[model samples]
Target: MADVILYRWSTERDTWVSASEVEEARAYLARQGITTSALPDGRFALAGESARAFGAERLVFLGLQQLRGTRSA
Candidate 1:
């Protein structure tokens, strides 16, 4: 399964607020009239007023992949 995560960059705190659920992220984006597109790297990109509406400087989509043939530290 793909581990999809959404993050909004907070300029004030210089950090990010994340949503683990794809549905939640989709709803939030829809409310803000934002749209997402799939990238070639298997990640998503946000467009439109998401940053301003959410009081964030940027919005990012993160797709987590497990490292195969690697030992967990």
Candidate 2:
């Protein structure tokens, strides 16, 4: 398995939205003027070096890659 990171933007709205409900919420991100890319293993990498050069927290986007070893499917 490979480690993946997801970059998430803070919501300016006072309310919350469900993940499934906001899967197509790229528009909300465009409003922030930040360009992001969703990477393999469900990770999101920063497209720019501005704002904060940070990685994901709580295994949300900073987990180590699972080494390929002997295993049976």
Candidate 3:
């Protein structure tokens, strides 16, 4: 399966936070062994394992997208 890109909602900003804005949270997730990558469009992504492990309430499901060029086997 392909990785899924995720966006986090920011109550303070009242919108979805950009990739750069998610760095702090990304770092925290990294410590827990859930690696995420920054996207060119100012979003972040998680692989299959990481995605399954991530359960942050701030994550915006509306913006969740599966990366292109990958298919489930």
Candidate with best lDDT: 3
Per-residue accuracy of model 2 over 1-68 as CA lDDT, tens digit each: 12111212233422233443233333334444545555555535555744434323312222211112
- Between candidates 1 and 3, the TM-score winner: 3
Give the per-residue lDDT digits (tens) of candidate 1, residues 1-73.
1221212223353344344444445555555555765445444556752343221213323212121112243
Reference-based lDDT, each prediction? 0.38, 0.34, 0.41
Order the candidates by lDDT, highest first. Answer: 3, 1, 2
Which residue pairs show backbone clashes in model 2?
Answer: 5-43, 5-44, 5-61
Estimate the TM-score of every prediction. 0.31, 0.33, 0.40
User: Of the candidates shown, which would achieve the greatest TM-score relative to the real structure?
Assistant: 3
Candidate 2 Cα deviation (angstroms), residue 8: 17
- Model 2: weakest 10-residue lDDT segment is 64-73
Candidate 3: list runs displaced more than 4 Å: 1-21, 49-73
